[model samples]
Target: MGVRGLTTFVKNPSYTHDGSTTLLRPHQLSNTPVVIDGKGLLQWLYFENDVDCKHGGDYREYETICTEFIEALHQRGVKPFILFDGASNPDDSKVDTLLGRCRERIQDSAKIIDGDPESPKLRPPFTTAVFLKVLESKEVGYVFCDFEADSEIVALANIMGCPVIGNDSDFFVFDLTGGYIPLSSLRWKEARQLSIPCEKYSLDHFCQAYSMRREMVPLLAILLGNDYVSRETFDDLYHRVIKRSGNIPNGPNVRIPRTIRFLQSRQNFADGAKRLLKDEARRQGKEECIEKSLQAYHIAPESRYQAYLQQDPSMVDIPDCPLPAAYVDLYRRGAFPADYINLKFRNNRKKLLPNLVEDYIRPSCHLISQRIREAIYGILLHGLHDRAVQETGREGQDIKVFIVTGMPSLPEFGSLPNLERMIDLEEERRKVLVMEVLEVDHGRVQAIRDDLKLPVATTIYWRSKLDLPVTESGHHLMRVILLGIAICYSREDLNMDDVKGNLKEAPRVMNRTAVQAFAEWQSCMYYTMHLNTLVNRPYPTPDATKLYHGTLLHRIYATTRLQRDVNPDWVETDVLRGSPAALALFRHLDGVAQNQ
Candidate 1:
């Protein structure tokens, strides 16, 4: 149940001399005196396997332990009430095999029976039929309980007025009370005599203290200790350490300071001490004193203290700075204190205090308005810009813009009054035409065309589909692009070459493999030149044919395949055929007369 490869316990037996009869007892049985000796008493036993063990091969160790425990119980005149949630295999017959093995160890006079009758449906390799057969033929009583399901089994036990035993704290989660004891804990020398007072502790009391429905026990552990961290932050730090240590074997351990020290000394006292100092400083408010104490302890460097002061000058007046450079240095050196390390790295007090308050006070309305503005901008750049550039053959600043305001009933257009005011300021600095599309007069879209005053023959009310009221000003820009203009497209329509050239200027965006692949794929699809020709022509010579045929196309194809694999939904087979503009240019070139 704990970490694998750690120390575990095995069961054994005991014998005692009574005045009238020789007495036998299981190692964990209570020392209470009984008038009868050699009388068969039913005993329930459970085994906790190492989680790290693989199936089949790992059962040997568990079998050995079970055998020892069962033999010890037999010598003490105790009958076995064997309950196993057989291994997670599909076969239901294995339970019988396990029962048969147990029968071999005990005296023929002593009976054995299965404790769990609801086990079959859960898909354990054993079924209830075999268990029932064994119990009836052997004349042993069975306690049928469904520990995995609802709390009714606990009630069933109370109704029967019999004792129950299992190790998990989860037993309380099922509203179980009275007659329940943890067998494993009872066997421990430290735990033999300490009995929980069930009368004072009701099922509700246990539920309130440790309920499975609430946060998990592990999460509760971190929160109680004030050291919880988020999973994302820990993963990020793990990768950073892995990168710093290179790709060498044991690199993760080598990069992590505490892990390295633990491996070296077979203990982690140095790291534990540093965390203690930090926790102490946080509580005491004496930053300078903590720094000096850490220095005296020889756990960190002096430069760290100076660095902390330099980073935040205002902290000089504050009693303590939790993030003192010395403490960070100690953390870097693998000497972090246990308490600080125990703190959850991502959601700890230090990380959540600043963000939590702001989030609690933030208004949802403001967030919605910002999101709408961003969506509009994306539609303009990605949906409309590309088609306009490709169809008109007009480059750069020749693109026209218009805005209209005056729609009243439409939901999206209703916001035009506010949107128009914002656009008014933007239009003053840019070459844009603005107009109002009235509802009653000439069609709102036609009015926009009149306002544009350009010789445009078409008129499109993009706001119509948007389900927004078509205010004259609100309709102008989108109307002109979608209807007035013969060709309309968004920034997504732009050639891949143009996008690639833009991205090359931003190195940070292309640092990751996914981003780099996107940029390259865009260049291949939109760039106006044949990439293969560009590379092959440069090295033209006797081996040019070999390079062009073998090296160049192969690499490009591989990259194309990788792009398709990475973004399966977006970059399909047809999209990778190369730049449409460049292909058209070649077609035009091929039509010219050769003799001329």
Candidate 2:
């Protein structure tokens, strides 16, 4: 959703020295609405706030950050519309780019484990889920686009006449009336104190500054290349039009300024487009690529996204595969996970986010969550028997792809319920179905709190699948899970502040084994959360603060290694004090694990 070098290009002194970019303030936007890039904001918020991406993410801290951010915007009277990017459409030509990013994330995860916290904040598995949870809690307006959110984000912003808040360079090409506000230049926090300096960029101002027709912007984007057409594809065109300057260093950085100057000399987009595609024999192919990329810049007066944001019932159709109305409604509302959509379109169930777990390891970390996902697939794709959802995970230093078709052959419990009526099922029936899918013994979580049942079920499955030896790290993982469940279910009995404080320690370097174990646990929880959403959320989702604090878990694991047994004493002042219910749950899980 970005033009590779456009972000850096716009920030250059040559471009900004003109009136193209101007400082904006919140007070100046009292009634002004803005559409934010949810996907971009997700990455930006997590990384910028220094949430512990190294040892898994600090979701509790992240939740707070998102909440405060939204609240700040609200205080300034900014009507914010957040838009999230969905999976790529079938004809998406960016597969190589997507796969390249996947590889990069995997490698970066390893760097983080090797004691480098500065790696590209490899997104944690449940970041989107957590972010959406915050959005709903705050009653914010948001919708997941049909495919890439760029065009739709622009479409919506154009309709509302509001600036688009994002870091994507595509905004530079779109002729938006409200212009674009890069998150990097936003001073929302400072705006609360006073009208702090912030920047807004408009295509009009840019065109005027460069003395180029506005139509040339899209052509300029194509000439520079984008996701649809690689910059290498237009190398011949760039060489023909752009002259070299010794003052500017060579690379993608210099391509923008030189290309813009050249584009300014052109009178019309048609003439520029013709010359750009006038290479040798493959002119037709180059022309088609240019048209395809150009089509992305065309914004319709009205978009299907409007209906979606309005929560209209008519906005629930997938291209070929027809999902139930109820499921579609949930999917649109952001209640349903995007994996279902990905399954229908690409037959690809996204792999869990990469971690320190070695790709060469047998029975990859994803194996721990395979059973849960199978149940999810069985329920979602029950009638579509011929379709197989592929689990794309790491396998021996390569991205492993495998088909999940074992659910149909497994021991029969109950026929897959009709998804349309699944949400309306009796609470006990829903509980039974959820437990059966999770493969948890009904008796184990029968007496547990209603909110704890689903987590306990997943916790049981996690332990059975893990089958780890008696090790301090293994026990620490179990204790952390049990403690999280206890905290969520018994917030009143225990001192919540004390509990958070106890686990509040800086992240330390963890061995690969510890990282792998936690990664597996996270995978288990993530898939179970998806299944939980599918079955109408029988229990409350575990609070991130209570369940998974990266720093706290690392601290607890380190403490466990120094002692023979894990005790509340390992941490300070009875982290488990006045929480017999939590203790009982831990005992039950430990007992189940021991017997297994």
Cα RMSDs of all predictions?
A: 30.5, 3.8
TM-score of each: 0.19, 0.87
> For model 2, what is the error of residue 88's alpha carbon versus the real structure, in angstroms, after optimal superposition?
1.8
Q: For residues 118-169, write the lDDT of model 1, one tens digit per residue.
A: 2111101111222333344453323221111113224333433433355433
Q: Which numbered prediction scores highest in TM-score against the true structure? A: 2
**Number of clashes found in candidate 1:** 47
**What tens digits encode model 2's per-residue C-alpha lDDT throughout 429-452?**
766777777777666776655666
lDDT of each: 0.24, 0.68
Q: Give per-residue lDDT, candidate 1, residue 207.
A: 25
Q: How close is candidate 1 to the true structure, as a TM-score?
A: 0.19
Name the TM-score of candidate 2: 0.87
Please tell me which predicted candidate would have the highest lDDT against the true structure.
2
